[model samples]
Target: MSVSQTSGTDAVDLAIIRELSRNARISLAELGRRVSLSRPAVAERVRRLEDSGVIKGYGVHLDLDRLGLGLRAHVSLRPRLRSARKPQVLRDRLLAMGHVLSCVHVTGENCYELTIAVRDAQHLEQVIEQLSEMGDTTTGVVLSEPVHPRDVDIAAWLLCED
Candidate 1:
């Protein structure tokens, strides 16, 4: 169902979503307190959210730099595939690669955009070479990440509904 039509995602649920987005590691009691609900009430709401697919599985945010992957880059792929099956083949190849953090099929000149983490420039070059085999690649190394992931603006979504 569309989000606008979805039940149980009211202001309270939006508040819960906002809190969880900021920190998924928050305890149930803390989450409840933040949303001004009893722990059990909040738990039920959370369970409903999960069942409805409004809340997907939680995850960890790893520090790639701490893990020796000091370099991060965005790779834009413009496919050179002559056959229809070649795009799927490229996707499969990317899915199997450990360094590919995320790949998105996009509009415009680039068919796919990928975020990749690597140990250094050499590793980045190696990954780019692999990507080049499928299509032309334009890579931009990330100097700094001013905005991190998982910081969704749930309030803005509610505003847009009006």
Candidate 2:
């Protein structure tokens, strides 16, 4: 029932997944039409997908600029010697900060990489200052996203795996 095992799924299931990835809010009738299935059949298949853990959940994409948090930056942290042993403490602190969009633990000169959104330069400075208490921080402001975030190519990935 796992995503890589298409034995549990068929072409119709894959088609439904492709459509949902493009637009999760699409109506069931529309989804059925796109996949050549009845509405009830589509619904049942979706439920099966969910129950099998092939489809985890849906999420909303928010506009940071519209929310007045236009400044997006990436901060790389090389922990101070004292804090290097307990990375979880720093992770917990980041989880409490609303400005942190994502944090990844990495293998490199830097211990953690964080993506943060703030209101202005001052706000960005404030976030950096806070991070500095835990580690040496390097920050870079994002100019633009040329390639916007997108869904995974399910067929190319899950289907082609041997």
Candidate 3:
């Protein structure tokens, strides 16, 4: 039988995802009991979720500061010339930089928003110089982050009625 037959897009899937999101190491038998499915069924569904790219992979969220990464900066960059080609080239270069954790193409005056984690001011300055070579960038160092949600609302995203 298809994996969906064992566990399809129903409340069961949501429960499995929620449980897995909380602790990816949870045993299949425990997950089965929580989601009202057999252990084998739960395993099949989880496998399918992985294959489908829904459950990408499990990872440990680290404390960057504890790991000696003392600086977090959000950089807004404006391309020297507004063109599709320029942004792609700039993005490629930014992605190669070790300090850049994430780079997102965004709207507004800036073409890209980069989330950079670095050792200190000197490292941050080097990253800024590299990015600024292609485009102008405004860097804002993070002072404090009160909250950052680890889990996304999967049910809301999956079952949007609109």
| Per-structure clash totals for the candidates | 0, 0, 0
lDDT of 3 by residue, 1-162 (tens): 433344356667877888888888889999999989999999999998899887899988789999889899999988785552375766667667777878788778887888999889998998889878777889999997876656575654555533
Task: Please report how far candidate 3 places residue 15 from its true position, in Å.
Answer: 1.3
Compared with the true structure, all predictions reach lDDT values of 0.85, 0.86, 0.79
* Candidate 2 residue-wise lDDT, 117-157, digit = tens: 99999999999998888789999999998766555667456
The alpha-carbon lDDT assigned to residue 66 of candidate 1 equals: 100
List candidate 2 segments past 4 Å from native.
1-3, 6-9, 81-88, 159-162
Best by lDDT: 2
Best by TM-score: 1
Residue 108's C-alpha lDDT in candidate 1?
Answer: 91
Ranking by lDDT: 2, 1, 3
Candidate 1 — which residues are off by over 4 angstroms?
1-8, 82-88
RMSD of each: 2.5, 2.9, 4.7
Which 10 consecutive positions of candidate 1 have the poorest summed lDDT? Answer: 1-10
Model 1 agreement with the true structure over 1-162: per-residue lDDT tens digits = 535445547778888888888888899999999999999999999999999998988998898899999999999998787641276776688877779999888899888889999999999999999888878999999999777766558645874674
TM-score for candidate 2: 0.83
